[model samples]
Target: MTYSGDVTSGGAPAVRELDRLTITKVSVGPMDNNAYLLRCRDTGEQVLIDAANEAPRLVELVGDGGLAAVVTTHRHMDHWVALEEVVVKTGARPLVHADDADGLPIDAETLTDGDTVAVGGCSLEVIHLKGHTPGSIALLYRDPAGTPHLFTGDSLFPGGVGNTDQDPERFGQLIDDVEHKLFDRLPDETWFYPGHGKDSTLGAERPSVPQWRARGW
Candidate 1:
């Protein structure tokens, strides 16, 4: 599905409202990493994904409601360059999978597969997918009146799965998790937001699973 929204000033990115959730996608840092702000319309409770960079802009997005949590998809420097600043400014706790919690800039709460994070009345289910990193994860939100939305940190993307280790075993694991845990289960209309670049849907990417597997990357 196409998302049309107003872009913010100073490279703040555009805001897309899906049902009760308002998502703002911003590209930041030298790597051009994507940071997303998810807000619950009814309660104004918000959750940030990545906190990749540009602390000032992120703080501006956080505003007065502050953030309920900042979820780090994996233990990657590019994804958390502004984590400390954003967390400090918003007083929002940082969360990461237990396997990747250590070595983060600050203390973080642990999230396991199937764990649900509540943002006001919205619920985001966590799905841990191994490969790109031992603890990479994706969050799924099913809108009551609309299609389900998925926030895949660095796991699944539009063109293909996230880059993985050269090792065949690691690549296999990632593909397995994605195919079984994601593609096989979720509906075709599910909207997937990746860690970087444009968004896509399961319907759009489903046909390429075989191609992705054969390519082995």
Candidate 2:
């Protein structure tokens, strides 16, 4: 089936295929966190975006091919509830931003703003969008044959930026980084997957940048 990017908690995943990689998005946990399973066609190597919840299910999704790493987008507990179990089951490396590493249940490979995380031969550019958390990061995978795909963990969503606890400074920082690092650099056609709920393209959310800024959400 074609990739729709719409998934429900406990429902089926939405799969999108590119020339070199395949992305499978599944919604898990009570918060309805979205975990992405990326497979490299050339190497059969896989990496999971977040082990949010349902360890058994996530391990099942991983299967015997083994997981290279489990990337926790931020320090949010809702995003890494199953990280320990999933890692125990698959021995996948844990990767997270430096600021949020202490919040995780286990030690993680600290990532900097411009660090690159690879899934087989595919390289994911890490964009650090601070404010929602001190260590929030998004993964950018530019398809060789098509537009870019972004996995934004609670940073840039369909409607607005991530929650900043109603703090004006935090909100300002997040919006600015998101606009500069993401909107300003990436094209409108870039397809983005959020930490929760459905997916959308930069084109679909670009016009609302001013409104999101004005409202400070």
Candidate 3:
């Protein structure tokens, strides 16, 4: 949600622990993009999503442990720059889509649509949301309470959508995927965690559909 706390004295963004997942908002490079750490509650397995540019901070947060996987939403430098350090420290498998899987600096498991990866008691459903990047993906997982959670990298934001300057067709496809695959199929109560900004429920952002369609689709 709101980034309430200030950055730590060490130039690292604040870290928030959510149940099993420990989300560290690493302030890296000039952009200060957000990086996430997802750890399993039961097995203590950790997964880092989008390290952005904060390699050192990401390493610090993921001290020696079961670093299960490194899942990147896309191949942007901001998202994967720190991935090399993460791979060395965690020894976790790197996950990404087949289209944009290259120069990862680490070995990765290329994933396709409908593929599932288990993190603790939950399973992450990989959904292709192409817009920000050709192989951009959103990871879906249901919490123990049965609440569906979507980790939409840079595809879908709270009140807005990701930038689509590169390819209009890909961007249009992303909008279509969200409309038909996500909003139209999933329940309105699904919780969304984007690549930046506050978290929101599907119902809260559903109204933005018309806006997306009018502008690009």
Candidate 4:
């Protein structure tokens, strides 16, 4: 599916298409993290990308059953602080990779790469990126409009890329995943919504891959 939109200051206004599914971004927290609410216009099925620090807005969006579940890109507090509230409000489970699943403020359904989640007539495929954290996974799916979307938590950014200085082996592993797994496998034009910063397409980010790799981050 082709998803197109006019570029804007906060990335592009989420593209609305004939398909019932729409992604509304709720910019939350001190760093202005992007929390996405994936909704099915027709069925009212929704999935929350990150709870971040905005419980009020997040809770308001969870009123519809379209908010099927919460999918966290990583275990960071900023990304998950409101998870419990959203879960309580929507009665939806929180999905996360098994590795970073521990010490979560709330218990969640442990997930791994390749798991498929269906909500509001949309199904998302899970991809294990494993760079930002051992269990870091990216969600991949094509909206009804046929636009390919990747919800990359803190893994890949517009120009800066994910921080790997936390752990040497982990950081090195993340670098490898970006070069071989994410950049190579996914379509170059795939739209990427990272944990922070403006959104960018895989094709748009390809030119910087070399620079990212050269940094040995």
Q: State each model's CA lDDT, in order.
A: 0.88, 0.94, 0.75, 0.76
Q: Candidate 2, which segments miss by more than 4 Å at Cα?
A: none
Where in model 3 is the C-alpha error above 4 Å? 1-27
TM-score-based ranking: 2, 1, 4, 3
Please, what are the lDDT tens digits per residue for candidate 3 over residues 92-117?
78888987787466668899989987
**Can you list the residue pairs that collide in candidate 1?**
none
Q: Which clashing pairs does model 2 show?
A: none
lDDT of 2 by residue, 42-67 (tens): 99999999899999999999898899
Instruction: For model 3, name the residue pairs that clash.
Output: 52-78
TM-scores for the candidates: 0.94, 0.99, 0.85, 0.88
Better of 3 and 4 by TM-score: 4
How well does model 4 score by local distance difference test?
0.76
Task: Indicate the TM-score of model 1.
Answer: 0.94
Q: Cα lDDT for residue 12, model 1?
A: 46
Model 4, residue 97: what's the lDDT?
90
Name the runs in model 4 displaced over 4 angstroms. 1-15
lDDT of 3: 0.75
Residue 178 CA displacement from its true place in model 2, Å? 0.4
